[model samples]
Target: MPEIGAPHKVTHQDGGNDEISLTGLSGLAGESQTPLAHKTSHQDGGTDEISVGGLAGRQIFVPYNAKIADINEADTNKHTLNLETALSETRKIIALIAMTSRVSGSSVFWVYPNEGTTGIDLVATLRYGSTLIIKDATQRLQYSQGFANDDWDLYCFGYVVEI
Candidate 1:
């Protein structure tokens, strides 16, 4: 029944809820001019909050202690993730990539928009457990590399434009 594009190997190990998905063709390009996803609501520490924009259609509250980034085990890609120069000074579109459990390395992570580039356009390409979320439809921003010396505990959400 399955064999058109391949990549359906749900590994349950033994428990109950184990899922797998790879629905193909994210080769990018949904057409970009960015902007088109704005919604908003307020109140945080006092509760009463909602931010359903996911890609910043207006719900762009984004303050999970401000975009954490730590990649040890000898970081590379010239070592980045110092975010919040207003989200690394423009150009962001990740959506979500929350990996915690200290995230050990298997290598391969990219989500870039800064540090003066010339080529190599990427906005997301993480590995390890993989796919907690990856929004880039061509909003683009891939810039990350290896990890081993410090382990990992990275988080990133998106939308600087393009819903």
Candidate 2:
């Protein structure tokens, strides 16, 4: 029998009765094993509690896209898009590609981080065939357009990183 809290040797070849503890595994660089808890500090005076192995300072990119079709001039309300479905998670937008199928001569689209934000406080201004490369941390996005009596198809493509 194995001692309590000690590493156990696997004697079964079927791999069905194996017991393993993360504390028993050797860390990278052959260091002594320890519990999988790491705290990292950020430049912005924030910290993250990481629990997994080999996941520190690594970013995973999640693809995001939204299509707003048949947007008319009367549709002046702020359209809100949630970058992540989960409310507890926040994501950073790294890049964006905004395309419009039809645009009037004076048409313009504004992208912002919050509701009730006017065009003056926009994070990005997009027109027909616009691709923007930016890094902004936000959980939700607000989109609105400026024009009248025009039908447009808006397509947005971007990638986000969960913070």
Candidate 3:
């Protein structure tokens, strides 16, 4: 009978045992050499760094929201949404939610990573309230609608890494 919230010694059938604690678990293969810890320093006024699960980096998420009204109906041209005003630096897009007002008669929306006619299409669909998990890095995004007079709302949750 082991105590709750205490380190328990786990025995293996092969006559091996390892101590597992409530805070952390061991016995995993190819684990990181660095221990899980958080350090704060005020000498140089730097950000805090945390090492968890064998990964070390500064974890920061910035919420981004942009709304475009009356997107010039569905045309052959694409509209650009500049994120410089919302986010100062270029960030990795972790997750993005694209929402559009309800429209009738088969409407589709496309989100691109670059401007102009040539670039990778990040999203393309006719459904509203769609979520996309992307790893593309950029400061701006381009969008186009299938129907005329459709409003688009973009919500982005991005992660910024400090060099």
Scored by lDDT, the top model is 2
State the lDDT of candidate 2 residue by residue for 1-163, as single tens digits.
6457654443433353553434545656355455643432332234544455556444555544666344565666666655444222355554445555554535566655334344421223344434444334544556666655556666765544534
lDDT digits (tens) for residues 1-163 of candidate 3: 5467654433332233542233454555334455544333422234443434455443455554544333445563576665554445554444445554433435555665334454333234524444443334554567776666654445443434322
lDDT value for model 2: 0.50
TM-score: model 3 vs. ground truth: 0.39
Native-referenced Cα lDDT, model 1: 0.41
Q: Rate the local accuracy (lDDT) of all candidates.
A: 0.41, 0.50, 0.47
How would you encode candidate 1's per-residue C-alpha lDDT over 1-163 as one tens digit per residue? 6566654453342243562333453543433335543432334543556545564444243433333555564546554333434355344444443333345656545443433353221223333323332233433333455544636556554333323
Candidate 3, RMSD to the unseen true structure:
14.1
Ranking by lDDT: 2, 3, 1
What residue runs in model 3 are displaced by over 4 Å at the alpha carbon? 1-59, 64-70, 86-95, 103-106, 113-137, 148-163
TM-score of each: 0.21, 0.37, 0.39
In candidate 2, list every pair of residues with a backbone clash: none
Error of 3 at 72 (Å): 2.9
